[model samples]
Target: MTLPADITERLARLALPSQAVIDGAHVDALSGETFDNVSPRDGQLLNKVAACQKEDVALAVFAARTAFEDGRWRDQGPRAKKAVLFRLAELMERDADELALLESLDVGKPISDARNVDIPLAINTCRWYAEALDKVYGEVGASPVDRLSYAVHEPLGVIGAIVPWNFPLHMAMWKVAPALAMGNSVVLKPAEESPLTALKLGALALEAGLPAGVLNVVPGFGAVTGEALALSMDVDMIAFTGSGPVGRKLMEYSARSNLKRISLELGGKSPQIVFADCPDLEAAAQAAAWGVFYNQGEVCTAASRLLVEASIKEAFVERVAEVAKGMKVGDPLDPSTQFGAMVSERQMNTALGYIAIAGSQGARRVLGGGQVLKETGGFYVEPTIFDRLQPSHALAREEVFGPVLGVMSFTTEDEAIALANDTVYGLAAGLWTSDVNRALRGARRLKAGLVWVNGWDACDITMPFGGFKQSGFGRDRSLHALHKYADLKSVSVTLR
Candidate 1:
């Protein structure tokens, strides 16, 4: 795919920095190691960033610990923290275009999505958390006649956040915003594949008047920097968003360490059920395609398993296939491109491998199962669908984490619920029905942590987001996020 003229101009104008931020300053890896930032589009080199390891991770954790203990940030009033965060959000908005370009170039996401969805959501999250800082308060409890009692939340010192590459900026902010808003210092480890935006955020936070060492970015591979953060005894909490295996490893690290608080938001093979009672089959089909195909189906809450009523199975699948076919794939920088390259060659291969597995399993391919744009040297896969799916089939049970959908038919609500809840994953589920009773009942019965009725993957800062089973525990957004970053202390005093 040829780079558009405007994209070329932006690429020429933007200069991506390669160092990690520690104590509000850019620095090289202690071992002087670096890793290439390969653009999945056309397989070009974006830049080489510091490959932070145990030494750098130790430095960052120590900095955060010092900052927290100094009382510069942890003792700051809510209004002061709010002011700095608001400034940080403003700085992000000011550099929105540059951040978006870097995100698209580094993560293989379309520039439009980076600009319109990822960057804006990240900024709004910061602002939202900033506003929330002053609104929450401690509480006083009814006590014995001779005593007084109250409860207050206190910051948990230093926090470690390991974020994924799919939505690098937004995911980082999901951890950073609330943790900082609650007056905790943080060390963030961005995924190796996409570290540019997180580094940029660290710089912006410093420029926004965040105190030194309060927000540090360690850019490197997960095995090194991530593991170090997970195992760091100085860090009080570990908040991670990634695969289940890694999440489990972090939990183990916590157990082996100081038993610090651990919050994990992991994988999902979420189900979207379409009933004949849905008001509009066409809309449902369109939504289903968008739910699975958005972000190239890299979303944790993507509706990848489509369970349709037997009456509408054929029609819904056909319509969804058409919708998937209509989505364009090309250069991520192009404004018209709907789906861009996969994050890397390895990821594309993973998606293709899943397609091959489906074929071998005798699942019928409905549309798209092969590589697209083979001439471009980009990691691109066609939006794919597989039918003849049993609840136990690999395609239905496992998270393909690409634009692959598994289709099945159910005759009754009980069967639909059973098939939807069959997988160990319970991150999210979607159902479309005009019957309010069925919607309510299905939502209550779904094993997933989040249920969407007549909608899919719509999130608000107000809602708690997490999973029920192997998908991992603990929520990421809303007021619930504060719980992960602080300790609630109960106080009682005896009357003289």
Candidate 2:
């Protein structure tokens, strides 16, 4: 596994921390077991990390509950919490290169993306929540002549966050930063495939002067670590980002246990609709290619289904294919690689399996239908596109977390709307049109949590980000995220 001299030197200078961070200290698993940390970059074993189990999870949760009950963090004023978060964000910025390198090596994303996109976004997310901390206000309600009534948002005890491998650090902070800003302690379970950055962030949280037990990280498999967190009666809530099946199981765990609040950000088979009268076909094609190929198409809201007006279907797909072919696929540590390896061998195989299924189902492969760069021994797939796909085709309906796009054509506006909403997932959609009326109508009619106009995946911290229907409920980004980590209390007082 060859890397740039600078990156190689940095990797050597940094020592990988294997123990889980609990109660502001790094500790080994209670069971004394460890798992090999494999790099998708070259199918090499990076190191062994503690394979935490239920016993470890229990200890972490107990510590978190103790901290919350003792009011170590929960008792702090909003401004105080904000200051700590700001400090944490500063620490992240200072160690930006190291964090970016860890994320790239762990998740197989391009180093440029890890540095420029993921790290910056995560830093901003933390800073955004920190800045908004003291701005949240309690609400006053209509009261009787002699009485006053108001509602205050109080922090929940403990938030159990199970983040996915796709955007390890960002997703963890999407839950962690908000929960902490709202004054809730958190126990995080990063995905088994990529736990390095989450562990690093946990250490950073401690270094930021966050109270002991306010943030804990248990790195292990979902079944052992995540399931334990979900089922633990001491946990106050469980926030997750993963597959629909796992999300459903977590909800079930919530019900069967103490009915802890559950916030899920699940899968999506999002749509990208392009009308014949699109304002800019060239830009639309570029956005369409990015929507499905960015992050190796592991994004939950990836625009996998492309619905174009029949008149411009061929031209639009051709344009998108050109952009796909132009993308650079190689070692993630490379500075110029646009696309990187899949997170793991399992995910790479899953993507290839879907490609094979598309061929057998009679869909025509327009471009990039198989694996590429076998010499590197890294998991790589071509930026794939399939045409002649029916709405009911499995390739169009299922969430294939890979760089595979399916193209379909529609004759009327109604048909396009219907096609976009035909799936159980309603995470996000993109619509391109020249007519103002059509754009407004399409945005209103689409059964998705977020609708992009002439763009895709252009999200900011201010906007509420989540999904509708089977894509799962509960928002992630905006001020709305605070609601999941808080409990509203209504108070009424009689005046003399």
lDDT of 2 by residue, 377-443 (tens): 7888889999999877889899999999999999999999999999999999999998999999999
**Candidate 1 at residue 174, lDDT?**
93
Taking all chains together, each candidate's TM-score versus the true structure is: 0.99, 0.99
Clash pairs, candidate 1, are none
Q: Which pairs of residues collide in candidate 2?
A: none
The global C-alpha lDDT for each of the candidates, from Candidate 1 onward, is: 0.92, 0.93
Which whole-number lDDT from 0 to 100 does residue 344 have in model 1? 93
Q: Worst lDDT window (10 residues) for model 2?
A: 369-378
Reference-based lDDT, residue 190, model 2: 96
